[model samples]
Target: MYASFFGLSQDPFSIAPDPRYLFMSERHREALAHLLYGLGGGGGFVLLTGEIGTGKTTVCRCFLEQIPADCNVAYIFNPKLTVGELLQSVCDEFGIPHGHNGPGEETAKDCIDPLNAFLLRTHAAGQHNVLIIDEAQNLSADVLEQLRLLTNLETNERKLLQIILIGQPELRTLLARPELEQLAQRVIARFHLDALSLAETEHYIAHRLAIGGRHGALPFDRAALQLVHRMTHGVPRRINLLCGRALLGAYATGQSVVDRKIVAKAGTEVFGDLPAARSAGHPKAVAAGLGLVAGVALLAGLGWAMGVKLPWTGASPTAASSAAGPHIAAARPAASQASAALAATATAAATDHFADLFTTLPRAEDAAWRALAADWKATPDAAADPCEALPAQGLQCFRSTRTSLALIRQLDRPGLLTLTDAQGRPAYALLRGLDARNATLLVNGQPRAVPLATLALYWRGEYATLWRTPPLDDRLKGEKARAAATAQWVSQQLATLPGVATPASGAAAGDSPRERIYRFQLAQGLVPDGQAGPITLMLLNRATGVAEPQLQK
Candidate 1:
């Protein structure tokens, strides 16, 4: 109900385990890497445990999507079962004909025999089998032992079945039991996922909002965002609950922006008795009155009298210009001098360019996307979202907040810029061209070159762009195997860079590939996490001259 009011396409904070909404924070990437590492560990238990609602299941779902076609998977979400019942469920999942009445009517042998036969047959046919048990902490000791025995089915090489146990932190405690030592010993890989850090929480919120089609600036202010992390303790589920309720409250109060007071009130409603921030004690009536006056002043000062009509609202101009006149007079120089050097160079040429841009600005966000598509020389389906459609042509959409022009220059790619217009409304322009002095932006299907200083005045640096991923090799499906291959690839690419010594006995000589990647990331002004995630890979592709589009000079 509040989605449209907030300029969102859908509810951003739904609790559903949607992989598309997953935020790949550093910890989440590490968690996913561990799961992938287990896939190539030659058939053993891969354990992933986290607190409830920490996103283990969501990560697993993403892992499932990347599973190789040659692997067969059986997923069991409910593990509170007897050995016979579990075997039966496994049989049901794999569509094996395990006949015998219910649990009491069958010996464990009856189910194991057919499963073993199936595994051996599939193994002989060069197929791998994976069994994933969620909520495995509830598994009876006997059932877990039975699962361990299933791993015993083997050829001369590796075990026939690979089992992954995912559950809450209690699962780790359960595995630490004396009797379960053998099972714990067989776990070739393990990772414990922790709650999001404060920075990650902020990114997580922005990620969901972007995915949910939020246009313009965020509704919550920076202080409120920080407060959200504090109130939710960085747990995703709690964040979702509080943020969803906060948006609803803002809508009910007829407010566009969600300030600290709104968030505190929402937190109180969601988690009883949480005190509001000290500065939030002002009565709502006075705040609303001030907000109304501020609103009129802002709109009246928009300079829309330049003949650009309000497209979204179609409301007539308010006659509050008398009150707004002085405010606009006082703010112009502050807005214009966002950069002293750029402001100094902002001559009539740049002013004329901006005027034409405002008069012909495209209102819908999709127009910016279409402009970006044209940069790649690709056509997207008219009825489909461009981001979703372009993937078929091997492109993926990446969005980031709190970004800077230097980072954009380093990436060296054409992208969309979310700019605030004279009306203080969110406006998107296709950034097809860039240079030190001016940026060439595509607005309303026309190109305009505006001085960078003038550009800085309207843009707060929210950017969305597309990157092309190179075709994958056969090693794409297996986690550890792929990591090794990727490391080798990274080494080869680094060798081609100027002044870099040849990678000599790197991993064997303590200068590991991860360390090299970290150094390379630091040099490239990236996060330096030592993981070759999408951004890192994209830079590699660019440096290596992969046949992708580059930003216009």
Candidate 2:
């Protein structure tokens, strides 16, 4: 009804999996990349999951349209089937004549025999057979195990069948069950689809309207778009539902342009009355609510309890958006739950993720101080605050937030990064060392060597790095020219600090004090390649207490 009034040929915001209406946001495009990569791989399961309405079906349909000609795909939309029924459905989708006997009887054995034969023939013909199961979270454990057995049917080079399992986030949890460890191992690629961002949401609405034959300007105004994003949380299906209703409301009210009020009024009908909608108008109330939540979260030994959803910090804006960098989008499938938890910790520590905003507490994240502490033989205090306890141990902790790779590399010293677990309890990691190819992260005092690319997946542009120097003066930030003085100062301090290894005699015999500085760099977790720039001096200043000692905020 609204379409005709707005001069559109069709309904633009219909929540149907229409290929023509598909809007591939950056996150969705990365999702497609993972699926397509699976098809080109040595044949294993490809997993795609998201919260409901993240366009898994749209991506899958898109994948199907682009499937290779030599590949035969059997797409299973509903996976709530018994093991026998699932096998039969696969045979039906593939047009494989199975479960028939010479006596004109059908049995499970009959089904298996013909299916295996069909797979062998397909492989002989130099073709690939892929089985894609959607809503796979509903599959029974025994049935999932059966699917795993099916994957075992293989040739010398690869399996006879490649599978793609698509479902909601629960599927990831389901697979994590100890019983499904084998099946989980077979998932060579996995991606979690996130909601659209505010910018992408605008593009999505426009793309759908254009596809629906809107030739001129957009019907919904800017305010309308913003409200729609807030109300729908940039979820595609929710956006569609709300937009469609908003258009209807505008048409009913005899207004041509959909505005903020139209969306606000329509939201009542679509999602029902809620306290959250008032959040925009009453920030103080929301803040109070947030405080209550934070108290509860902290008491419950949880961090996310601070809010229903994690706040988009300067560095941790809805991770995987265009803001988080393209390399961060292809989420490295976590090696295990422990690794996954560590990634979460990394994100929460990215306090400087916001473009213009900086972390209020600068001295809480210095990786240099953490590194110096690590080199010292003292066990980090559990009973005493690290800042206070370390000082008693003849050391001081200082922190700073860095926003980019260059800024971090500029500091050129060991730094402590804050990590938050799923519950939101913040943890800390010492970035012991890094190079072009890898990073040495000290998680819980255990050294974890992670690929540079893998670490980027969780690095949200903010990490707490430590410095042992007195507080940094803004003018001295990039002061690279004074290396000799700073190195000499640190060399003398090393002997006084307890358990610190003093440099070998003649270490400073060189004209430039190069070996002495290199020894100091190695002690402080700087990549000991022996080029002293501003980072070396800044760290050196921190080590000799040239800056004022400050406690963590």
Candidate 3:
């Protein structure tokens, strides 16, 4: 009902893992790095543990994006199976067909033979195999031992198959048992994923909003974000639930701007029970008093305008007709215009809304593109062959290498960067470079000094960079400058497309068009108030062809 009122293409705070809405926090990056390390390490077990709702699955999904084609990966999500069932499941995952026998020993041997043979073949081809077990805490000791046995099929150089155990914190406790000591000892690299910090929480919200087509500050006020952080403790799942509810609340009440008041109201409605001090008084009495005065004034005005006199006994038909005359005619045109405008608006909004929905970025799949771009930009010296330099920069540079890369750079500290490839190996080490006050990177044989502003932008998830070492004047002179100018011209060309219709909401009886617009703004991830501010204007301009007139410009 409130969606059209807020102008949102879809619900922004949905709890479902919409790849488009995935916000990668620093902690998440670290977790992914550790997983990549384990996968790339090529032997032994890699363990990942985290509290519930910390986005462990998301990290795993992100890791899956960079896995090499040569490397066979089996992701076993169900851990409740017995040893025989587990072996059978693994076989199924690897597409190794085997009949279900009567005995456990036969089942194990049947599955193991094909798996070992596959591993041997993969090893001969210089490829690795990985098995990712999610919710691994539930795996019984027997099942885990069966998994350990699969690692026994390794060659003298390194294990043919790698096992990754992902589970809640309880998995650590389970592994701590003396009986499981052998399995625990085999874990070469382990990382515990944690929730985001308060600052990261704020960034997470903004990141999701931006991905959802928001170009400016969204419906969430700073205080509201703080409250959400406090309540959710930076857990992505919890934050999503709370934010989603808050947006719904803001939309329902025709509130475009989601301030603390709206958030508080949403919190109470969703979570229940505000403190006595906060819940102080009701506004119903004041509203009733205002309504009474307005009603009396309306009646008096009608009586005078229609020259109708109300008798002490009853209202005469003649008097009633005189009073209703202007109202009936006034209502007809107003109602018709309102209906026509609403239909037009809804039809327009629905078209643009669907476009936004379909155009969303797929989470994890784009990791390669992002990684390749970053690697290319960072390695100017390797630029002699941009294609070749691409992979070294953290991308799959060549099809021949059979390598995949995933790299994450920290914004707060430029020197703190981690790059990992398909086998989960660290391809580049730049931990020290980010610490320097003025850092220089060689990309495609071109040396460029990195500016603080450029670093800041990258940290904020912006793709491009502004080079500091070689002055801008030197690089952009003549043809380069003309190319840059032409790029701007292309942007103008793209901007000329037809405007998209804004999303609409089911309006309340008393709602004005501006009120509906405000709701639409909130839904679209803009501040909820009905006014079209700069942020809303930008989104509108981007979605639609109509350029909002800039008063300042």
Candidate 4:
């Protein structure tokens, strides 16, 4: 009803899980990364859990789109069935014939035999099969056990069938039961999707509005957005409900913009006279009836809770938009670019890292990326997406949720680290220096040295960094014209590295580029896939003096 009034092409707040409207927040990206990691994990249970309406389904939908051409997927949205019914559903979804062939009814074995046969047949054809069960928390113990047993079908190398379980937090608790220990042990990857922080909430709202085709500035000001986050607790679904109604409230009352008043009024209508929303007059509550609304403002209080900065610190939205830039930047020689005095000052500031100075910068993700960009001395277009803009400067961004501090140390560069803050929200910090015991983190762009133990308390091994793109990078896309150039460069770089023999003549027989890349990868402790991927190239760049940031040891 308010769509035209708001000049939106569609109802931006619709609760549908539309992929176009999917906002890939830092947490959502990690959740999707975990799902993607499961595809190559050789076949085991990959679990994703979250609170209701926290975007599990949305992430699953996004994951579905990214499934490779060779992988066959069977998805079950409803798991509230008996073991037999679930087994039958699996057969039905996979198109495997099961159930009674004769007079008697079919047993669980009836379904398993055919399913196993199907899995083996597909495995022989070099195709992987994945079964995703959504709302798995409702699954019975017997059903869960049967699902686990399905994983027993395997080859000597890997299990034939991979299963993914998506559900709410209770799913984690359910898996923790003593009886389900065996099943839990089989989980190869798991990530809990947390609700968005206030900044993310604002971005989420703007993302949906932009997808809905809104023009110009947001109808809801910053205060209204803050109120929305407070009322909805940063859950996407709740934000939708309140924002949709608040827009309608604006349209009916003929208000041009949605302020705190409209949101509080809409909250009352949506949440009703709930006790939480009807508390006695408190200073935190803006109005007598807005007891349920969050009283704390998003900028200062939210920043402190999550250990990030807000726009009040003189950083513009352009900087905030690049928060967690699309591509991960490389981390190395960070201190090399800074003057010795500045580097020493940053190192000294590490111990007092979380001091009052921390609150005066941009968001954690933004500060980390900016700090990284500064270290590299590459100017990425602030108004454009950093991932897209950085490549123009001969730089490449690599992001991975499965990386660790060990790998970061191996990469020997300063990069961004995702940390869990005091409020359990995802925070960001730039890792600039590391030694055995203490690591220096550029929190809000200031070096704060913290013990590895302290860093582990919040960091979960997810990181992003930048690397200098090799000159041969463009030729790597199978351009026939550059094939010789690419191979020659690869051979030359490898010949200079240790343990790689330099070819005597123009080219050595059987000494292909792939073989040389594989050998280089082995020496560098990278995945030896015989392909010159980003990380492999980054290591090569580092070894060949291609000049990128370096982490202080």
Candidate 5:
């Protein structure tokens, strides 16, 4: 309904992951860079981990789009399989023949020999092979060990086979285990993706709107954008869902412009809890009475004047002038004053109405803020620390340049958490509640959970917020200890491996795919420049021991 009114051609807010609508926030860009780096590195392992709905899969798809033509990639979306099943899946993915009748060991050899031979042939021919396992947290320890063995098929310089593990936080935890130390050591590069910031969230909304054909100012306003960010916590998927619903609500109401009122109504329906409507008072009653009077007078004048004919030319010029003069003069000031007074009254009433509404509505108690202030009052030096008395659970707190406050969970689970300015009443509430299981947080209408390891890895990053009152330096040290322990285990395991040979010095130094490509070029005596054509990647893979990926026919 709003489309025609606003002169728009289509719905601007949509939740679908349209490539055209992909907005590369800073974190998303970094995640994409890490993925591309891993793919281009050509050997060892690359890991990508993040929270659910942080656009990990989207970043992977974007990386896939940029891969070199000669690069063969086998993407495994589902990794929940036994060790034997995984090998068979890899064989199936590569179109390697597997006979029905054979001993397990014999069958394994048949698969491995052909795969190894193929890798050598591909290396000689100059091609890059990559295996990407999404939801890798599901892979069992045995399956992971089997994957480590696949990297064993290599020449003197590097191993033949590159593996990319993409999953939620659990995947990182799995790798961190002492048993999987070798696999962890093999991770040449790893990156944990994060949710977008408030600024990025606004950009994401606009980007999606533009992609959806919103050429001009659209329904969402700045306040709405802030509400979207606060409620969604800068999660793209949740933002999409809320925005989509708000747009639909605006359309349903035949609203040409989407304001806070429309947004609030949409939010209440989508999430819950409608902001209290302002109570009408004497001023509004008086205005209504005046409006009623004006209507009656206008209608009465029209009714009395109907069918009363007067000849314009026959009337005396002085009489006509006199008659029109009084009417025009009388109507001017009365009409102007009535219009001005009515507008002034309406404005005042509206202001009062909203002010009263905000004052009455439930708000996130500023207990944390009060506590910080009290501490400062008691001892100015101690005010620097804000988390002093904050509760542990369901309390999301952040410290920025301007404000430090705890975000209490008004509605836990998978739903929007709306926050309005202290002065502004809620104009919209478009949150959806979801249920979660062990590894998944249900979003919108779907269940998605990242691996526990992925969450653990992400929690180690600078952006991860901690609820406890541990010193920042101490937390940082703990994170370093965990990472070091994991890394050491991996190194020892890879070193003791029976067949695999360690990479030469300067193997995993590059920060990006282009950098890795440059390294590859240098190793092969090609152009030192970072441009990775098919030949460069192929040579790089051979040097690094990454097997050539082949498609199953």
Candidate 6:
């Protein structure tokens, strides 16, 4: 109807699997070509898989049409059958008569014997037999094994029965199971159909319109076409659904061309409240509309995005962009420039690359904590949170952003360096010793003296430094008591600082004490290194305008 309204001879965007509208993109051609090549060779399992609605079935149909006239096909569309039933179905599809054995007497082996006889008889007659199982992912392990064993019916040179498996992505995973190792090894060739790219998608739509006899300007405008791609992710079925609906929408509105707004409204009907659509439609709507609540969600989302598992949240770590991390909106140009200069100086100091003797440690975070324990003369759990665990040893973990090795050495303490590997995996290295040109690092408990340039190459200019908090009193027996007294004073001082949000009643001064400490350090013209040192503490005390510094040396 949309095609006719647009002066097309046929509904080009119909969701039905019509070979007339089968636009073969490069990927589709390759997938089809690969499958066809497998069919020509001696009998072995040929596998084809793809995500939902990527035209796997269409490609298979096209290939089947092009197959040699002498080839015999036993195509199974629905494979949800028991082992005996599956074998019987295969024989039935191949026109092989099964023995009329008594009830409950005909076994899977009984069906296989006749199929094997048929395959052997066909091979002698100079004809090829191919068994194609569609939706093979639904086939149970035992049923699949029955299929594999059927391949044993072979002649002197090649398999008498050629097998092909086609399904969704689940089919690929199903074949990869350890129990299917035998079947997997018999696979001669495999190909996965993928969705079209943006350019290919544009071509696909145009080609279909041309096929429908409407070659000129399409009803979908440029923005409308782009939105269709975003909404459908180049999935053919989804594209059809959206484009068809958008055309109807345009016709109903008495509009000549479909626009992005129409496509968006169509998408709402096709896919309700898609997350990607929301993010793309309004980048800052959530943050701006909800205000403070949005900030909390943003922070939580950031944490999850960074693959940082919060001990309290019990949420699994999620993969994110390599550059993804917590966003800091505050200005820190001095820190940025200083880090750049340090990186340059560090690179220039090493005239030659040192021998790479570093071995990646088994546990990166653990290695950093181990190095800190060595520096502070305290036993720390490898898995414990440094921020929480260090306090029990009368110490605290402070994070700082710094680039200068000299400043890090001036503090004369081991710290954890956050860096990215070549592949962009987050890595940790403990800065144990800092020399002029080389630095000793404990990478997961392995020791090495690497060039500062080597460290600078991967360092993210972020590190964690440990600080020993002076005991509150001589007779503070309980760790909780000491921590309470320290938290009370720190919270009070943090509350007094300008722009620092006060915590709830009976809560600590700042929600994230480390963040508060960083703000304080920056306000005092400190490095904002996120480390608590004598100088940062002194500056923080002065800015808090509090009596007697509670954080002692």
Candidate 3: which stretches are off by over 4 Å? 100-106, 268-553
Can you write out model 1's per-residue Cα lDDT over 169-214, one digit (the tens) per residue? 9999999999999988889768898998876787677668867877
Error of 4 at 128 (Å): 0.6
lDDT of 5 by residue, 441-496 (tens): 22223333422222221121111121211212224357677555534433333334
Query: Which residue runs of candidate 5 sit more than 4 Å off their true CA positions?
Result: 1-8, 100-107, 259-553
Q: Which whole-number lDDT from 0 to 100 does residue 238 have in model 6?
A: 85
lDDT of each: 0.72, 0.63, 0.54, 0.72, 0.52, 0.64
TM-score of 5: 0.51
Q: After superposition, how far is residue 297 of candidate 5 from its true place, in Å?
A: 38
Q: Which stretches of candidate 1 lie over 4 Å from their true place?
A: 100-104, 275-553
Kindly list the per-residue Cα lDDT of model 3 for residues 282-311, writing each as its tens digit.
444323323332343356446546875422
TM-score of each: 0.58, 0.51, 0.53, 0.58, 0.51, 0.50
Minimal lDDT window, size 10, model 4: 324-333
| Candidate achieving higher TM-score, 1 or 2 | 1
Ranking by lDDT: 1, 4, 6, 2, 3, 5
For model 5, state the Cα shift of residue 158 in Å.
Answer: 2.0
Q: Supply the global lDDT for candidate 5.
A: 0.52
Estimate the overall C-alpha local distance difference test score of candidate 3. 0.54
Worst 10 residues of 1 by lDDT: 313-322
CA shift of 289, model 6, Å:
20
TM-score, model 1 to reference: 0.58
Model 3 worst lDDT window (10 residues): 398-407
* Model 2 score (lDDT): 0.63
